[model samples]
Target: MTDLPQELRLVTAIPGPKSQALAARKAAAVADGVGTTLSVYAAAAGGGVVVDVDGNSLIDLGSGIAVTTVGNSAPRVVDAVTAQVAAFTHTCFMVTPYDGYVEVAEALNRLTPGDHEKRTALFNSGAEAVENAVKIARAHTKRQAVVAFDHAYHGRTNLTMALTAKSMPYKSGFGPFAPETYRVPASYPYRDGGVSGPEAARTAIDLIEKQVGAGNLAAVIIEPIQGEGGFVEPAPGFLPALVAWCRENGVVFIADEVQTGFARTGDLFACDHEGIVPDLIVTAKGIAGGLPLSAVTGTAEIMNAAHVGGLGGTYGGNPLACAAALAAIETIEADGLVARAREIGELALGRLRKAQESDPRIGDVRGRGGMVAVELVKDAAGTPDPELTKQVAAAAHLRGVIVLTCGTYGNVLRLLPPLSISDELLTTGLEVLESVLAETRA
Candidate 1:
C-alpha cells in the first residue's frame, strides 16, 4: 500500500511544528475564504492512513470527503495517470478527441444504473456536471423551472448555488443566484416525526405543483442519500414515488450522486438501493480515485438535446483524468469494494449504535455501507447540538483520527472511511471516537 504504515503512528502532536509552520504560511498566502477542517498538512495518504508533514500517521475516516473510495494513490490510478502524462496530458476532447475520453464515456454508460441506451459527457467537478444536467433537462423539456430539496448542497457555482439549500458559507451574499429554482421539504425521519415515505413525497410533490407547476419544471434533482443535508436517507418509497411523478409529468428526475456514487454507500450508486433509475445521474467524487473528473450520464435522447455546439468545456475530460477514471472503475469492480463498503457499514453502525446505548446525546445513527453518521442532540428530546458535534470532532483530531461533521444544523458527525482501510484501523478509529464522545459529553 505505497510503503506507508497501515497503523496510526503519532510521532508528534496532531498539528506538530511542521504543520503549524505550514498553517502560518497558508494563512498569509491562501485566501481566508478557504477554510480547513484540520491544520495538519498531508505529505502522503493511502489505504486509510494520511501521513502528515509532521510524520504523524492519522487514520483517514473522511476519505477526502468521499472522493478516494479506491484509496488515495491507488496503484492502478497512479500507473494509468503516469503513463498518460508521459504520452500526452491535454488535447481538449472537443478539439482533438482521444480514445481515453471515449473509453471513460463508454465505461460510465455501462456502469451507471440503467440498462437503457445512455450517453455520457465528462466535466471537471461535481458542480459542473450538475449544471450541465440541468442544462440538458431544460433543453429536452423546453421548461424553465427546476426543484431541489431542503438541506441539499449542490455546489458553489451560480446555478448550483441556487440549487443548494444552505446559506451562510455557501449561499449568503452570493446572490443574485440563478433564478427559476425552488425548494421543498425533504423526508427527514428524525425530525419528521414518523412521516411515511408516501406522505413525505406527497408533501413535496404538492408543493412543487402549487409553487412551481410541473408543466414548467425541467427537472427535479435530489441526492438519494442526501450528503451535506446530513446524510439523510429519504423514507423507503420516497424516491420511487418522486420518480413516478417525474415520469407522469414529463420532467427529468436527476440523481445528484456526486458524493453517493462509486460505492461510497453500500451500493455502487445510492439509487440502486431503491431500484430507482434517475433520468440523469451526476457523478464526480470517487469516480477517478482522486482526479478532478465529473460526468452527466443520461438517456441518449435527453443528453443529446443540447445543440451540437451548446455543451463542453476546454478541460472537461483531460486525458490523464479519463485514464484515472478507467483504472479506478476497474479497481472497484475487480476488488469488490461494494461488498467491502457493506462490511464497513456493519462494523461502524454496530459500534456507533452500541455507544448510543449510554449516550442519549447520540440521537440517531444511520447510513448505508461506508457512508455513516451519528446525529448529536441535546437529549432524548432530539434537540440538535452542533456545539457537541464540534467538540467531538476536535477531540478526535487531537487523538490522531480524522472525522467530519455535517447536516443542516451541523449536529451530525459523519464517517466516510475508505473501503481499503483494514478492520483494525476502522475499529481503532471508532474506539477513539467513542472515547472522545464520552469525554465531550462529560
Candidate 2:
C-alpha cells in the first residue's frame, strides 16, 4: 500500500497555523464570489490524499470535485504534461493543428459511450462545452427552446445560468438570462412531490408540449446524476423515458456528465448504466486528470451543425491538457479504474446504507461508484437538516478528512473519493466520517 501512500497525519488542527496564514492572504487576493471547501493549503498530493502546508494529511474524499480521478499527479500524467510543455505550450489547434489535439479528440470519440460516428469539440470548461452543445443542438434542429430540469446544474455562463435551476450564488442577480431556455421537473423520486419517474417525465413533457411546444424545442439537457444540485440519481425509468421522448420529438438529448464521467460513477459514463444514448455528451472534471479541459462529444451530423469557425476558443484544446487527457485515459484503462469504481460503489453504498438504517438522521444514502452521498434530515420524515450536515462536514475536516456538502437544501454530504484510493484509506475516511456523525449526534 505504500506504493499508493496511505498516510493521514494530523500534527495540528486543520487550517493549522500555516494554513490559516495562507487563507488570510488568499481572502485578500482571491475573489470572495468563489466559496472554498477547505482553506487548508496543499503542500503536495498523490493517490488518495493531500498534505497541507501545516504538516497535516487529509483523506481527500472530494477529489477536487471529481477532477483527479486517477489521483493527484499520476506519474503518467506528469510525464506526458512535462514532455508536452517542453515541446510547446499552445500553438492554437485551430491555427497550427497539432497531433495531440486530434489524438485526444479521437480518444473522446471512441470512449464517450456511443457506437455512432462521433465527433468531439474540446473546450476550456464544462460550461463552454455545455454552451457549445446547445449551439450544436440549435443549429442542427433549427429550434430555439432548450429544456433543462429543476435541480439541474449546467455551468456558470450566461446560457448555462439560464439552464441552471438554482437561484442563489449561480443566478440571483445574473438575469435576464439567455432567452429560449426552459426548465421542467426532474425525476427526483426522493422529493418529487409524490410523482413517480414516468409520471414526472410525462408531466415534464406535457408541460413542455403545452408552453414551448416540441417543434420549437432544440434540446433537452440534463445531468445523468445532478452534480452541484446534489447527488440525486433519477428514478429507474426517468432517463430512458426522457431519452425516448426526445428521440421521438426530434429534440437533442444532452447529458451533462461533467461530474459523473471518467469512471467517477462506476462507469465510463453514467448514461451507460441506463443504456441511454445521448445525442450530445458534455464532459470535463475528470477528462484531463487535473487540468482544465472539457469537450462535447456527439453524432457527427449534429456536432457539425456549427460552422467550422464558430466553435473554438484560443485555448480550446491546449496541448498540455490534451497530453494529460491522453495519459489520464490510458491510466484509467491500464489500471482497471472502472472496475475499481464498482468496488468503491459497493463498499460506500454498503457502509452508508448501514449508517442510514441505524440513524434516522440519514434520510437517504445513494449514488453510484465513488460518487456516493448521505442526506441528513432532522427526522425519519425527511426534514432536511442542513445544520447537521454542516456540522458533520466540519467535524470530518477537523479529523483529517475532507467532506463536501451540497444539494439545494444543503443537507447532503456527497462523496467523490478517488478510484485509486486504497482500501485502508477508504475505510479510514469512512471511520472518521462515522466518528464525526456520532460526535454530531451527541
lDDT of each: 0.95, 0.91
lDDT of 2 by residue, 321-398 (tens): 999999999999999999999999899889888877778898889999989989899975788998999999998998
- CA error at residue 174 for candidate 1, angstroms: 1.1
Q: How many angstroms is residue 144 displaced in model 2 relative to the true structure, after the best TM-score fit?
A: 0.9
TM-score against native, each model = 0.99, 0.98
Cα error of candidate 2 at position 414, Å: 0.4
Candidate 2, 107: how far from true, in Å? 0.9
Per-residue alpha-carbon lDDT of candidate 1 for residues 13-78, written as tens digits (9 for 90 to 100): 879999999999999999999999999999999999999998999999999999999999999999
Lowest lDDT 10-residue stretch of candidate 1: 1-10
True-structure RMSD, every candidate? 0.7, 1.3
